[model samples]
Target: MIQSCLTIRGHLSKSLTTAKLINIRHAHSGIIDPLQLKPLQQEGGLLDKLISAIRRRSAPAVWKAYTDLKDSGKIKEVPIQYHSMTLQSFRLNENGYYSSDKLKFYKKCISDILVATKKAQYKLDVRDYNVLLRLYGQSRDWKAASDCWNEIKVKKNEESYNLYMQAAVQCKKYDEVFKIFNKMNNDGIQPDVTTYNTLIEANGRMGNVTEADKLFRDYFAPKNTENKSTSIISKYFIKDANLSTYTPSAAPLSRCIPPPNAVLSPTTDTFEALIDAHGRKKNTPGLNYIYKTMLPQYDIKPDLKIYNALIRWYCHSGDIEAARNTFVDMEASGIKPNVAVFNHLFRHEALKRNRPKVAEAIIDYMRKEYGIRPSTSMYATLIRIHNKHNREDEANRLHTIYKALKSKKLEEQ
Candidate 1:
């Protein structure tokens, strides 16, 4: 019996060894799998530098040796300062954004470098804001963004103001969003519908529904008989530009305005983002504020996005009934509910029976008011509930329900 077992083991080991040899040969022949190397666009940059360092900057002698430094001729064409900035700012994890682990490392490395060098103290420029805020937002470090703003706002520029708003939201800084908005206005930058919307949206994120609602009415509403800060927008956006700088042609951060009245007319896209963000943050009060203040004042009305934010927020808040109610409210207010709002309802708020009749009401509203079809997420949630309760039949039936929804969707298409 022992001899038979040894023979069998020997044969199995040989077979496995053969397979490994074949794989090695294939790799050497350049028949290697395509997935092994990431797509070309995703490669290059930081990884290239690391590879060079790992290879000791020595090539096969057939290929050119890799070097981190720029060639003399190439260096001549580029501006010295910008080039240094680009190199210094290059993350070792170029596009490590695709992988969460790598991104965390990338952020940590940058933070370490910043702290170790105390670079923030020496140079706090717009480009620096761009890099840091982008990193912070990507990591949802909103407070860091706000702290960065506190350091720079007194010497603030318009670009920093815009970025600070985004970073603040990522870090969940509702108050800073408004604070920066107010500061920007006091600086004489014109506030538009988008700006007002972001302010309201940030407040909503904290579930400060009342404060969000009140602030919107008082500051953002155009005809907001209540808003005391309507002029705050125009006043702050241009404040420093008008009084401090004499060179308006220079970027605001340059603080090099030629004369007063240096007005910056930001595009409508900024305002649209505010609207979308409000919907995301579920700041219903902010939405109302925008409806009253921006529609007539800036001629900006609520779009699908504004409604989507409220609905999605309600959905995420796990109030299926509230989500559905908002869906109805938006339609009544003349806005349409989109697929995202529907998806979020199932994803975030899908609780089952004995919880409340809220889920049913939302489903009913979606059917009756919008005529929009339910999605897989809703059915899946039902399946989850059924399984949790050990109701096999109900879970099986929920699968059938999903199948029916899928079929109907295909038919309509």
Candidate 2:
């Protein structure tokens, strides 16, 4: 009996040692970390092949490898990690700019994978559906997003609802937003702050000011009680804007005093949405209403986005002076300008071409001051502008510079 016990212990030790040796071999072969970039030469089995395919951003290759393994009886069930990595690869392929045809192809790839997982009864996580929902939203394919919503076997959470709401809103399906919200409430799920913000932004996007205001007043308004006196005006505004309540800044109104006794306060993003909504509709009065009344009550400072929105509205209004003043105010507030701000100025110059020198100067300032290398779109626009003005020489020179820059980038890669 003692000898048998000794033999069993020896065998267990041998199995562990073999595993260590195999891991060491894989490590030396440079396929140790799955998450890191695989070596130029990777040596492993089906999992290694799948990772390689994912790293290459070949959804077709990934799908084929997965199926081949499944058919060969090597992998009985698709691992959750495999699904996640594959989805991540799809997201990587998104690459910021995708044509409608490319988007359609990506959607099909995801749908096929989802169908396979469902057939195998492999439980899907919300993350998987969330990616698909976002893609559908981008593609404006609300029908597929709705179908995905029904495919979830597990109870949905706030994030799931948010994705669906965003998808509906992206497609301008305002009615669908309310429908999903109602379903969420019916399921006894409480809407988070994001849910209300999305609803407000969606309504504001459609110029449904009255509806947006009602939604805001219903959900985000401070809770009231019979014991204390509460005024409707006070809910959205401070009694007075005192200097003591202000944070000192060169810009106009750095911060305001928040209202008292508010349980759920609206965030800066909420007011940004409101401002954006009014801005889109050219309802300057509505923007003033939020800036002077609603924002002060919430103590939400106008951040870079708010300033950009104001600048954009003014630019669209052809009030370049107003836009310039807003840009100065943004700088005064100590918020450094981003590429968006510069792009707006560039776009204005592209359209007007009144002062091509001003556009060139702005580009210089962006490059020298902020170190913002102009994007390809910016160069293209400038070149087109020069061409429009019959400055073929200038256009050709800029085109040459752009090509050289692009070549440098590729060589670096």
Candidate 3:
């Protein structure tokens, strides 16, 4: 059934491409000029074609459509929005990684748009700045993200602060994370779930478990009567355990009651951050409470990331039994274990625990049961383990396999 649907979609796409080519040929032949074409906003018109091309990530098609619209002299109708869409289209690569060349192109396009809009007296909206900020965040250019934030001429929304904070967190600017949050509050902008998640992660990385815990308790976790007296914003900003000197205006406090649409419940990412924080601190009781109690009470099912965190923590703490039990629970929950999960167990048994046989059994189980292959780093560690144990023959064997896999990967590339 899926194949049939795919076949039909292929035919439709081919038909659409043919139609576009025919239209272009007619335009080039002077059979139909730009003015003779249908209105730009009509169905299947130049604007729709350009938008479709952008959505498809076909740079060539987008350029062609854009050139046609430009020749039609209709691009001035809504130039900034069209430029914003074009900029957004170049934000990511096919593999979902940021490309430097794409980012450079995006910057150039943005520069050109800014110049054109300035001469036309067109003001750039918050969406354009938000897109630029998001691209900078993905590229890990926090400095550029800050510059973009400063360049926002219009009012900043929740997303603007969220993206800026995300970039800050990615660059390990933990102090800036809170500063942005405080600035966001001072601006009378309320944070959403993503904001709280980024704050939690930043605090977690900074080893400020208390701050992260407070954020979760105040904003994300389910609220009770005792915690309901103080509003969410006041609890974090005015009465925080840290940041004593941040005294913002009283205007924001009056608007602290979250709207009905506000997301106040914890998400999986919130739990993940809390789990990782406790794990890094070796706070077993904290991990126990989150994994065994809070998650169940909240009815939030553990995903692969959650299980991986548990396995990593157990492995780090030298509790192979607990790690194995977590792995078993993961499988029982019908969650497929990835190579990272096996890597944790393998590294623990082979290197730290000095049980190469147990590690070998794990690799065997991974391959036979799940058809999972060990990553190159895993092979390197296994090789080291075998060599340390004086198993020279096994070490050489694994070395040869690793080399072959590496060569194969390079050849494919």
Tens-digit lDDT string for candidate 3 (1-413):
00010011111121234345344433442111212222345433778787677657666566667667667876665433355445444444312444467667566665555665665454455655666777777667778888888878777788788878888877777778777877887898977888788877876677656656766766665555326554322222222245232224212322542433433878788788888766766666677678888899778999988999988987887777878888999999999998889999998888897877788788889989999876677778889888887999999998998999788866964
Candidate 3 at 212: error in angstroms?
2.1
1-413 in candidate 2: lDDT tens per residue?
00010111111121234345344433442112334533322223676678678757676787777767666675544444355556545652222556677788887778776666656554555556667777887789888888888887766778789779888887988767767876776787777777777877876676555545555655567665321343222233322233122112211211111222444578876777676666666655565567667777777777887777777766665667767877887888798888778888877876665666678788889999889877677777788778888999999988998898788766864
RMSD of 1: 18.9
Could you tell me every candidate's TM-score relative to the true structure?
Answer: 0.42, 0.65, 0.66
**Winning candidate number (TM-score):** 3
Task: Please give the range of 10 consecutive residues that has the lowest summed lDDT in model 3.
Answer: 1-10
Residue 129 local lDDT, model 3: 69
Model 1, 144-241: lDDT tens digits are 76666666643545555666775677676555666676677678876544454455456445543333444444443434244443332232121222
Model 1 TM-score, all chains together = 0.42
Estimate the overall C-alpha local distance difference test score of candidate 1.
0.47
Candidate 3, residue 302: how far the Cα is off, in Å: 1.3
What RMSD does each model have against the real structure? 18.9, 12.6, 10.2
